[model samples]
Target chain A: MNTIQIRNITKAYNGVTALDHVSFSFEFGKIYGFLGRNGAGKSTLINIIANRIFADSGEILIDDLPATENMAIHEKIFCMSEADLYDTGLKIKDHFKWIHRFYENFDLEKALKISEQFHLNTNLKFKALSKGYQSIFKLTVALSLHVPYIIFDEPVLGLDANHRELFYSLLLKEYENEERTFIIATHLIEEVANIIEEVILIDKGKLLLQGNVAALLETGYCVSGMAKDVEDYCSDKNVIDSDELGGLKIAYILGEKSAIPQGSNLQVSAMNLQKLFVKLTEKGGI
Target chain B: MNTIQIRNITKAYNGVTALDHVSFSFEFGKIYGFLGRNGAGKSTLINIIANRIFADSGEILIDDLPATENMAIHEKIFCMSEADLYDTGLKIKDHFKWIHRFYENFDLEKALKISEQFHLNTNLKFKALSKGYQSIFKLTVALSLHVPYIIFDEPVLGLDANHRELFYSLLLKEYENEERTFIIATHLIEEVANIIEEVILIDKGKLLLQGNVAALLETGYCVSGMAKDVEDYCSDKNVIDSDELGGLKIAYILGEKSAIPQGSNLQVSAMNLQKLFVKLTEKGGI
Candidate 1:
């Protein structure tokens, strides 16, 4: 099992840096969440990794081979993205045939089976299908590839709740059968919070945090009580954010929580991934 | 307080039916989730109510008054839809001004304030902004309008996780202050599951279910045990779906939960909205 190693990656657009010499490595067989703000260069980095675009500097290595222009590693990675680079005139069945010509490991029969489960008519032209079906079609193709690394950039976009749930289940089912890696970059954090084994957080073209999902979730917690009592307790600690409901105040604290004295009128609860993400990215006084 | 009553509405495109005798109403001052799969007629019904398209038959009454091009009722309803119907050349400020010209009650100050909070550049032309910003700009305008019923068709289309969280909080904050109805038609059901007061589900151009969220959640549960034990227990019940991980079997049952004999080797867990929707719409012998 070889890992994708990204070393000192840097890219710029019109003199503005998009990736600031970032370095990270994605292991071979784990589900990871690549999170960031709207324009935080998540797509840029992903595009660079897929060799669709070039980075200004630095290198990407699939084990020991350089990734760019190397057909050896190209088949090892597949990306299901929002870009409409597909042949719109081609029917789903024809597209599957087209993908088969590009990737030797592509499975046309599996794609057809998955499309049936999604209720997607394989005879319909790509452009004729609605937005949700288009996404579903792309996902079906992506999952049919026998690649070591698959990246999904908002793969569930425009999908209804039922379809989204089906996708997650299918993803888990596939993961359980193969030793492959899935880098899912999405806006629905809570939906994937518990599913992802590892998290790579990016903000404003930089890495904010990266670690195990469980460990990161344990980094912060909420302490709630009377306004004055909570304020006094959080005076010396790193409080990420606070919520106020009438006389009650809930303050989210970062780092390890120390022992609380007896009879302190404070309630502690674990912070969920959504709350942590919101507080980390929230501007002052929001 | 008024309600948007949809009575026996029907529509079709070309030879295919879109909405088949759909009838439902969104009450004033409540947030409702209009749920459906792709091509399930959610957008068709919403378009008919917003007067964007003409229904083949039936009626929509805004407080007992016909809502077809009736200026009195039109001003009371505002829809932030996915269609790019805005003038592209106009800046954010100019668009707000244009809306103010048409909507006498449109608050320009509120729009500007909300835009600032979203960090949206108000001087850029509508066409220059990214997809996420476009949604934010639309939401800013929609929230500024003083109307009895506001409809959102995929409001958070391209927003990031942080922005989506912000939108939900802001929506609840606004609803708390105003006695207005919010009919949010979205694909991201779980995001709005807890926030929405009611749920309206549709499938195959027909009404599936509509009721309070809590009541719907209580309608089903998951029972798990050994394969034989679970199958035997579910033989006399309404089983929505079931899963088998190795020898352990899990069955999702709908309707009232009955008494289980002691040491029956079954565990019952509550069902979430997403799970219930998937089970109901899922087509197969899984």
Candidate 2:
């Protein structure tokens, strides 16, 4: 099987640990959501995998080969980080040409087509483009590259509503047409909640949860009713989080839901991905 | 009445029109979502109101007083934009002290309390903060200010899921405790779908739609059924968009729902805000 295995990785900066013994394997041919709170080691780990930075301990294997200092392994992965690494003085079209020279399998035709759809002016320099269009330009190059795994770090930053919609639709189209894998790290969980097949969450440099998105969501149920009734019913149950609206209350519980007594006012429904993420990573809720 | 009124506002840059006679009034004590596509003039209009940029024509009034270069007008509004305007070498704590000096109503006590909640180290200089923490600091300052009107331009740019959740909860808490107006411009429509009471949509530098969110949603409905049957039924109907998957088809329609013939096998559901937005602004769809 094709997979990128991260084996017991750890990284620190100035005595502050950024990643702590994180271990996980991202399988090929699947769309995964990499999630975590701020400074949660998501970026550090992605940097390590992309070979932009090195970890203090452990190893990363790209399809069973050492990823560090291996030029061939770098060809298998493409990371589109939030930082713009392109030369600012070069024109947009020229940058595309440069990327074409670097990646043997780059699709220059598709990149130009995407730029047209985004209404990006190809003649302008990289520094001349607006912030949103700068992101669009980088995304265009990333999507058109021919790689086994493409990791997007906050792909939709500075984008507007219409462009964001267009990006998602285009991404879905690409997924349906190609066999490549996509690993997206973004804060807009609700938008990608339906697109991602798998979910991985980290907190404070530790893996908090990893599973199929649908199956994980199925295990979360919100029980809502009168405040006193919800409070009493959740007294002995595994309630992850809750909310209050005057006399009404809703408690989020985990695991298989049990039946309520007949003629009860309580109601149960599945918890959404965003709500579950908040509860799972919340300081006191967990 | 407390309000910010934009009358016949128009702006252009390098012979390209940004805002074309845009007119709108933002009333006090309500949360509003300002949305548009890239280069659609959302930022241009906002900058005009905040006095960051000039409009070729038209005027803005803050509580019936002219806002153009009026020093007192700045006191009524606080805008948190995407650009980093703070001195890079100054510490976060010193920046807060500087802001206190600039704004007579600056709430230093509240800012300190919020920093503690966000786990921000005030001793770190502005240049030393991560992109996400920089955003956190900006949001911390914006939310704690005592201005009557606050505008956040992409407030949660690089924030994580947990920090975003905390920010929204804190915003709602502040809203509940005070009488103020918030105008937020963000691309994550679904995240703010239920939070904002009103919606304002702009496209190609012109106002497209504006109304209460609930009333607008009531006019959008989606119908789905077998591909052939859906096509035959919606052939002449006012369908905004349609999607097909295998033998199944779904069509999005606007306006009030109509009675369906018996045994049609068509399923109807409410079209959500994000889907409606995509269909409405999608090129060639409207």
Candidate 3:
């Protein structure tokens, strides 16, 4: 079922339209990748959905009901933005206590377990912890909230490789047990591509594409070979982008392997989500 | 000729060893990747090389001359750290003026062109700009400096995709023209893998590996297939990491293709720099 839906949503700041008639629906029991270039309305859409900000026009619904300042609907949703939302002077334990009271499904056991694993200091004030530790604190809350609809906007931004891996594994485990809806907005596409079942592409405040992860990978190919040979074979095809090194070239094309011509001496392989995203958002001369 | 050399360098902070008996040398005209996790002594090493900090023990030489707070060797090196060196209250143009006066090779024309392309406001104060813009300003100075040795530590922390591409292209153009040495310390390995000629991996305050990029890629492989097949094939090999999805599994192994046994039904391919780094640094089993 569609857990969240928006129709003709529009948001503007001064003279600029941050989101223009953007419309999409989120299905339950699936992890979705909300992807776009920086400032492509991902955060704006999340804010509107979470009811933190009102859209200039159009409607939004959660569970087939209007999401207009409805505390019941808001209680079911949790939005974890990139910015820290902790009170600077408050102790970490106090912040946790407040969160536990705010969310009905807050799991204290899970929070405590994560804190132990991360080696968090509950006695320290929020401002005293390092940036990485602050991120861990925020993540602890988000993970423990256990809301039906959880949104994470670059949750692992400052985390090291070890912490990032741990975050992904923990999220996967939680999803397997809870079957909750998750929407992750991040620039680290390749890392989460395997975890996300659904992919949503947004560009210039418009919905570009949405589908299963495997389907998107089947549509694009990365061809590597001599620059001249690659360019020649990529003619008449949608060559999204190319990276050159000396005489060799790797071109990311939006087409199946059959579209590539024979005798090009090129190596055609599946295009990684990150590489495809970079190619699609490239500046010029595709 | 080696442009920068470090012999048994050791540093400590409050009796805690940050860099332990580190020794390395950088050549004249190659792009090097100084890779490590956060707090892996990358900043300390760079500061010592730039003469901003003194090593507790051992010696550093730049251009065959000791780097002992000597203005001569310091003038030939440029280090761009996260800390802002410009006066925060001054306008962008004024900061450029200061940089032009301090660095003999600073190119005002090139800087102006890049600033225009990046849409940076010359009249805006450094403190008034956004984090991303501040990073771009620093990048502009580093690019224009044209020093014999330029070191960038997490240069694109807040930059988006478009700006990162522009920065990489600009760095390449400068390298082609001047043949100077560039050392980049960052965690975003895959993004810069194509441009980096050499890779230096540091783990737990010690050097793990350092060599050409192509050689590293040739050694690390990612194999994917049935879970049982993958597990069996990876049992005897050095499996750096693994990811499971339903009945399928993928494992990143460090070895040559010919080492694998037949009848595994596995598809092997080269591993990405980021994936390899994660695998090598992971503490436990995948």
Docking class of 2: medium
Residue range A84-163, candidate 1, lDDT tens digits = 77999999899999899999989899899999999999999999988788899999988999999999988888898778
Candidate 1 docks with a DockQ of: 0.66
Pairs that collide, model 3: none
| Residue-level lDDT tens digits of model 2 in B1-286 | 6899988988989999999998888899999988776777888888888888999999999988877856877689988887788899999999999999999878999999999999999999999998889988999999988899999888887787778878888888888899899888877776777788888888888888888988988887888889887887777677887777669998888877877658898877667787788767776224
Model number with the top DockQ: 2
Candidate scoring better on TM-score of 1 and 2: 2
For all candidates, the clash counts are 0, 0, 0
Candidate 2 regions exceeding 4 Å error are: A222-237, A242-251, A259-269, A283-286, B222-252, B259-270, B283-286
Candidate 3 has a TM-score of: 0.88
DockQ of the candidate models in sequence: 0.66, 0.69, 0.43
Model 3 residue B106 CA deviation (Å) reads 1.9
Task: Name the better of 2 and 3 by TM-score.
Answer: 2
Candidate 1 residues lying further than 4 Å off, grouped into runs, are A221-271, A283-286, B220-271, B283-286
C-alpha TM-score for every candidate? 0.86, 0.91, 0.88
Q: What's the ranking of the predictions by DockQ, best on top?
A: 2, 1, 3
lDDT of 2 by residue, A98-144 (tens): 98998887899999999999998999999999878988998898789
Could you give candidate 3's per-residue lDDT for residues B1-286 as a string of tens digits? 4568888989989888888888888888999999877667788898898788899899988888998857777568898976676789999999888888877789998888889988888899999886668888888888888788999977776666667888899999999999899999877788898899998777666677788999889887888889998898887788877878789999988877755566556777778788887766665222
What CAPRI grade goes to candidate 3? acceptable
